[model samples]
Target: MSAAPPTVFGIARLGKRTKDLTKRLQPGDIAIIDHEDIDRVAAEALIERHPAAVLNVSASTSGRYPNAGPRILVDAGILLVDGLGDEVFEGVRDGQTLEVAGGEVLLEGDVIAHGTDQDDVTIAASLEIARAGLSEQLELFAENTMEYMLRERDLLLDGIGAPEVRTVLDGRPALIVVRGYHYKEDLATLRPFLRENRPIIIGVDGGADAVLEAGFRPDMIIGDMDSVSDRALRSGAELVVHAYRDGRAPGAERLEELGLGDEVVLFPASGTSEDIAMLLADEKGASVIVAVGTHGTLEEFLDKGRAGMSSTFLTRLRIGSKLVDAKGVSRLYRQRISTFQLVLLALAGFAALAVALWATPGGQALVQILGARLDALLSWFTLLFSPRATGS
Candidate 1:
């Protein structure tokens, strides 16, 4: 007798990128993606959507580095099928009902694609291999950094074609927020600085939402506008849509459809949104740039599953002196009590002292003396009212 076949059922939603697909994904839907080396952020997003299962056409963990995406999905009890290949996409259409059983993708009782089902053992083994490849990734990162310096040398050395926006950043601090690792915690930590300095707030995509969540509005929002919420777009922040070097602006189209295109600014560049944001601030004459939740280290960039970080490296080189990470700022910034705060403190101290004196022995003696005086006055009134004393 043949063994029974395993079966998992859900509607399939397909996309070449995890981020793009997640926007349309609904609960209990199966996500079909071609994402290679899934990042932690992408995994978190998919988990948030509560998908039934994830089917990847490409390798979820390619042994490039110890990526946590697959582990995250599997640990969350979401079934993950790896290396199903591009054929899976052709076999399954968007919103088509499909069945997955024992690493086989089935379309109406037919096996469309065969893949390896990932579990704890396999994922852990892959992570070990990825850890071994970290050195190679580091070398490649260095090479890419050198190449970026050559390609973007002109822009880095000389501010060429930097867009001029209405937001004045000259000689002031600019807070650039990215919704990357620990952004909420970092934002909370910097609340004091935000209150005191009131730096120009620049939110990169979803970071706009973070700013709004932290009880503040962004002064400028710069990004592709895909991940950002509609609420953030209509936040009255000066919108700067990042365009490609060829002047293709997809974000602009989204803005126009939402009736917000009239006031939007188009900035055509060749770097990531966060990079552009830093350059925008630096070019606008900002004295200092404090970055919150921005990727700074090699591992951080790797976690995003980037082959290279050329633009980020060059952007940092250009604005090295002015740019500082949130951690550094939080550590170095010292809070000083203002004169008004000191005066308030003194007043509070006096009020506390008055309450303490009112509870003391001397305070009770003073009350008794006042009571005796009131009694004598009352006795005098009674005597005056008597018939003998009045000649009634």
Candidate 2:
């Protein structure tokens, strides 16, 4: 007898594998992407859509650095077929019903492409190999940082060429949010602070959506405008397009097409959107700047697949004592009362009330009333704690 064929599941949905592709993804659709060294953010967005399977044309974990993306996908029970090459995209049309089994992409009962199946064991091994190459990455990062420091010293030290914006930041706290790692959790944790303080909220790229989700309007939206939604553009937030230092504003075109040309402030600077946002706040004389989900640690920068966080490092140095991480704030700040505390406080209040009533002019009458209530309470307790009759 012939061996049984492998079970195939779900229809295929082909996309460029960019973070922008998350907007079009539907649940249970197999995502075909060309993303190499998929970062945590991209993986997270893809995972949220509940993709049936992921077929990557480019290397998901290229072993250049230990990216958490492939591991995250596999750990979530999502089937990952890594490095199928560009042929997979050429053969698989968008919305085509393709069967994926054992790392083989099948179209109309024929095997179209084959890839390495990414399971826990395979992903772990890849991560180990990637870790070994981190020394080289670190060296490259250090070099890049030094180069950036030399180039951006004027901007960092002197606040040269900082654009003037209508959104006033003088003597006010500014909350700069980025759609990076644990952004939602940080935002939720800082709810009380946001409500009480009402800091000028600045959203970087897709962070605009996050700000909206957190029930706060962004005072300023800053980025290349690639990942931000059209709704967010029309959100009445002051738009600042991050352009090149050479005065080329590509993101301005997006706003112009959306009929927001007149409202936008063109900020031409050579840095990441988060960096620009921080600099803008600092330059405008913000008293304090609280950052949510922005990359700070070395590992975090690497997780975003960056060679180095030159702009981020310089921005922090420029901001000095005013900069604070939302994660740190969330962890250290305690505002909410515990249930145990509430119960204990209630018991203490009842005891204090009894003592006060006994010391009053109507103490005798109050004691009599309390005595009757106590008797009733004892009777209720007796009934509650009494053994119930059970049927055999």
Candidate 3:
């Protein structure tokens, strides 16, 4: 079969699916770059692998919109066909031959029947539709751009030290810990650090739970009020509500319900839940802020459905060296079994073996009988006092 000129669609799911349409993309395989936002990392990976002409179904063709994927592709010299929407997918499904001239969809049919309504549709037309539906998406992109701008201004904070590690006497560094999906795992690992009071802890909404679970209370909680629990809200942690671009705080309503309006600080930013938390920590002069289970890569940022990690990316730049990603910290602090525990277990095993050997056949029989009696006795004691047994 002859290779079809690859068309990049803006939707990720479709882009991934297009691989099945062609055997092995030699030169003519059209790259359908799907995704409302082009995934820079995915695009780079795809570009490296296929080297095919790209049909960008994404929202942005110009890098001005902060869609890094498109910008990267354009820079990489990949032939990009912009603004072909669901029709592009239909084209492929029906085995249509697509033609692109100067990043414009010139002709979009071969085997597939082209509809009249779609006939006059230019790249601009598709972009207009995307703009209307994805106005929010563009804003998200813009917010990310602003966030990166903010972080760029504060690049000194990008290290692995507590905020007050050196300057203040008896001053512990400030820590911004995350408690998203990996709260338990992050807490389990961060427990010892909390115990040492290394930094002031700030939790990103649910991260407060992580702090408490790590046996510490968060000095601050940041995010829109949705995911935080009642127990977490009433846990006496200071609250910071992340608001939208208009400064209208969605979290403020929940705070009022909990009578915590006064306690709540409104932070209007266009970043993720985790981004606001770091910003709060930085604004408050936190010496060090550590993030856990926070979105770090392109996929993670996209998985959160955020068009850009603009705020997070910016916040990291703002607190550059001081903002330590928790993944890195976990890798640095991953636990190994202690030698003492190993030694103790070894001794216990030897003692158990010694006792087992000492009992001869008749003695072993007697020992077994005694052990059974002891087990029954223990069970009786457990039944009397155990919470489950006592129904208490």
| Candidate 1 lDDT over residue span 1-392, tens digit each | 95564468999999897877998999999999999898877898899899988999999999888888999999998989999999998878898998988899989998999998888889999999989998987788789888767755666778776787989999989999998876777798899889999999999999999899999999999998988999999989999998987889999999999999997898888768899899889988998999998887766788766776777888988898899888445445545789999999999999887677679999767767878999999999999998774555
- Backbone clash count for every predicted candidate, in the order shown: 0, 0, 44
Q: Write the per-residue lDDT of candidate 3 for residues 248-339, one digit (tens) a residue.
A: 98789988988888777666655576766665566556667767777776545654556666666566666679776766555566678899
List residue ranges in candidate 1 displaced over 4 A. Answer: 1-11, 93-101, 106-110, 213-215, 229-231, 246-250, 253-264, 303-305, 327-392
Q: Estimate each model's TM-score.
A: 0.73, 0.86, 0.46
Look at candidate 1 and tell me the lDDT of residue 385.
Answer: 90
Assess candidate 2 and give its TM-score to the true structure: 0.86
Ranking of predictions according to lDDT: 1, 2, 3
lDDT of each: 0.87, 0.86, 0.59
Tens digit per residue, CA lDDT, model 2, 1-392 = 94443455777777784686677889888899988888888889899999888889988888888888998898888889988988987887888898888888889999999998888788889889989888887787789888888877787888887888999899999999999888888898888888999999999999999999888889999999988889888999999999898889889998889999999898877768899899989989999999999998766787766788777887888888999888545556555899999999999999998889888879869899889999999999999999999999
Q: TM-score: which candidate is best?
A: 2
Task: Report the Cα RMSD per candidate.
Answer: 9.0, 6.1, 15.4
Task: Name every residue pair that clashes in candidate 2.
Answer: none
**Which candidate would rank higher by lDDT, 1 or 3?**
1
Scored against the true structure, residue 364 in model 1 reaches a CA lDDT of 68
